[model samples]
Target: MNSKLVILGGGAAGVLIAMKLASQNIDVTLIDSKTFYEYTPALCSVLYEETDAKFHQHFSEISFELEPFLRKINVEFILGNAKLIKDDKVFIHQREEGIEYDYLVICTGSSYADPWKTQNGTECIDLNRRINFLNEQREKYKQAQHILCIGGGPVGVEVATEISYRAPGKKITLVDMNKTVLANAPDGIGNNAQRILNARDSITSIMEQSASQKGQEGNTYIYETDKSHTEIKADLVYNCIGVTPNSEFLQANHADWLNEKKQIIVDPGLRVTSNVFAVGDVNSVNEPKMFYTAHMQAIHFVRNMSRIIKNNTNVENLIPYHPSRPNMIVSMGPQYAIGYVSGIKLTGWPLGLNKGSHLASWGKYTIERITMNSCHLKIPVNEVLYLTSRP
Candidate 1:
């Protein structure tokens, strides 16, 4: 009998790995809490106005149903939470018996404050639930007169600027503990973002400040800044601080496999043990936790896994995974963006050409389609609407 391979998480890493392995006539089972796989990089576009219907789409449009895609690729899809992992066996939340596997890969990924980054922890498990949740948030954003965005990172900055483009008159206060926006990025990029935020209509940038939620009354949210000790109120507050890894399931018996930040620790080959491996945001690889990074890791791991299986090679013979240099594109709005790639700073028309008028929504859609195509799944009509490669 062929070895049984089980993969956890349905995000970029796991999904891509499953597709690649299944193509090689490998038997694989994928378990994930989310029923739909979302193209999370385009999540910011969900908050903004749809100036161009061809480029803009609802959050649901970018999130493809997982079962159909996985099944089409000859991979078994299990819709359940992974509760525990014992030696050679994995357990689910409601199941009493553990599922046996010859090889295991952990790609549980991370969770964000926003619902768009839904994975294992998110309450919206199905497509309908996610659609309703996103619609509710969009309604709140449309009616909000004052908005507070806590954090000056990519997510916070993108949310602030996207809302600004949609509702210019709305008063938006962006607070961050850093000296400027995009604090983790290159200094020049952050400086450029600060200038853009300052010039944007009614979007205020309050740097070197941190805010704590006081409470909420009706639709109003109250917050207090730490450094300034000032109280601010807004109709809506977005907590875009950062993401937490979905590695809590490993805490029961495998706590030693995790780091202080609760991320899984793996070797250079992305292996946790002789038969176990970890990938994507859940792993502490000292690299940027972007979807592209996750995708690259999945491709590399799949290649290594193929060698181990077909050639019956030892673990030491597997190729080591090298960390790639950081590359990121931060979209401020539909027409403008700033990026860092190959140790060079980029902005304006070059970014505009890459991201298009819809703020990289097209590029993200293309990525989703490419993944779906690789898995031998049919693209839905809603997704096909934005299929043009003009971006």
Candidate 2:
């Protein structure tokens, strides 16, 4: 009998793993909730007009590109959300049909948490929504004199900087409870960002106890913090706190596999309990949550799976997962960016242009080309069963 391999979540990790395994003729099947794969890293860039939104395309096109290659390797694609896993089989639910898999890989990407009080409140997950929200705030603040941005992380700083660039007439105040912005980044990064934002005529950075309202009549957002309360008259407020893992399904099902943060705990080889593997932001790793790191983890896991399927004695000696070298391409606006690459810190136009073009070109060419070449090999099942089965 042919050994079956199923992958859940068609995000970067899921798709990459499936493509790798299918190339080795592992009878691979991929599943996802959405038909389109959004390039999340570019979403902010798209909003800032550094890249075109049309760059985000349907996954079907990607699937089509892989069809011939995958068929040659005996791999199949399924569109559905996996609901549960029992023993060696996975249960999937789409419209009204049910399906199962022999070996499963979970890669369901994350979703933003709802910000409202209600359980079914609106949650912003995509680039368009974030852009629309920012645009709406821009319009709303056009008549006012001040704007307040909450949170001081990378997202918060980027949004504030962009708004400052777009609306020179309005006063932009960035508020954070921490001592400085970009707290998790290297020492100079946050200070440099602060300097850059401070240089702008319309931007101001405030480190204090949150703001409080003395009176609720005027159009202002008040935040209450620990030390003292400060009030600023503002027409709009943008909140860019942080991200949480997308693990609701796992929590509801195999909670035992998860750690305290709700991230799936994988062994050194990236395999979970049984013949399962987890990757992407959904899995706990020492590295920051970013696209490149997730892709690397997926690639590593795929190689291990290939070894198992090849009856290779060195499967346990597969390459270990490592965090990518510290590199960040943060664009301040259309013309300005800051980051470090290959241990060199960069700022201004060179940073902006290189990052912008790199992002755009990567999306347009590199990913697709890599996917094409990596998804076209075939391997036998007996090798996997022989190598992986418990002695």
Candidate 3:
């Protein structure tokens, strides 16, 4: 009998792995909480009003070629949440049904680490809701002229920049407990971002001693610092602190497989345990948790899994995972962008052109296409690497 392969989560990593393995004639089942995959990178663009408010595109529409591929490979796609893994069988809880699987792959990704983590809450799905909340707060105090964004990370900086661009007349203050924005990034990238933000006419940045106190109401936000208490009158407050790994499903059965930060500890080959693996933001790696990193890891994991199914004992050594050089593109507004490519940083019109290029859009489409094709075709990574590296 063929071994059953089960993948949890339908995000970038999970779908990519399932597509790759199923193509190798392996039995594959993909389980996700939602029926459609949501594109998250577009959230930043939406906040700046660069993208439409209702710009949520379905994965099926985005990757139309994948349906036929999935059918050809007999890959079973289940819409449900994975509750736990026990005795090497995955326990899935659908709306009113339950199922089990043989081998499992965990790629549940991460969740926004908010202050209300201790309580039960609903997760925010799209950028529209976030924007709507901000707008509502702004309107609640029409006379209020200031907005404060807390946290100096990429998300915080992006949100502040978007707000400044969208509502130029409003005073925007960006506060970070740390000394600088993009603290984890290289000095050049952080310095460039700082300079750009400082040059903006409507934004002010400050380094606070601590993140003490909280709560915002209308035009008042009170925070305590190491030196003293500080309060700011703002129409709105936005928090973009960070994310936490989504590993709650593994707590009961695979607790030992998780690290102190609740991230799954995967081996160099991306295997979490015997005949099991983890990928994306849920897996602990030395690299930053970005979409690109997740994409690479998913590809590597699927390739290794395919080799294992072919009775190859040396599958683990087929391809050693290596971290790529940090590359990123940040948009200030509709036609302004800053980008870092292979250590070479550029900004302004050139960056904007690169960002708006059809090639960039097609590259994302190609990733989805390759992911779906992986379900029925074995496209070599060498070719993918070569194509992606082409200028």
lDDT of 3 by residue, 1-391 (tens): 7878888777768766765676565688876665455445544444344223332233223323333435666788765566777777666664444455556788888876432111112232333443345345334434446767778877777766766676688798788877677777753566666777887888888775445446666447665445445665665566677678888878877799999999999888777767778888898877888766777777777767767778654634645567656766555554454556556555543443322323333444444445444453324642365236322
lDDT of 2 by residue, 1-391 (tens): 5567888776667766765676564678776654434455534333433222332332222333333434565667665566666667666554444455656778876554222111111221333443344455334645666767777876667767766665577788888876777766653666566667767778777874454444444666555444655556666666656466666666556899888888888877677765777888888776767655667677667767777777743544655565555545565654566665445555543444322323423332333444333343112221232233212
Cα-lDDT of candidate 1? 0.77
Better of 1 and 3 by lDDT: 1
State the local distance difference test value for candidate 3: 0.62
**In terms of TM-score, which candidate is strongest?**
1
Every model's TM-score: 0.87, 0.72, 0.77
Weakest 10 consecutive residues of candidate 2 by summed lDDT: 115-124
Model 2 RMSD, rounded to 1 decimal: 7.8
Q: What do the candidate models score in CA lDDT, each in turn?
A: 0.77, 0.58, 0.62
CA-only RMSD, every prediction: 5.3, 7.8, 5.7
Return the lDDT, model 3, position 143: 46
User: lDDT value for candidate 2?
Assistant: 0.58
Q: Which stretch of 10 consecutive residues in model 3 shows the poorest summed lDDT?
A: 115-124
Query: On TM-score, who's better, 2 or 3?
Result: 3
TM-score of 3: 0.77
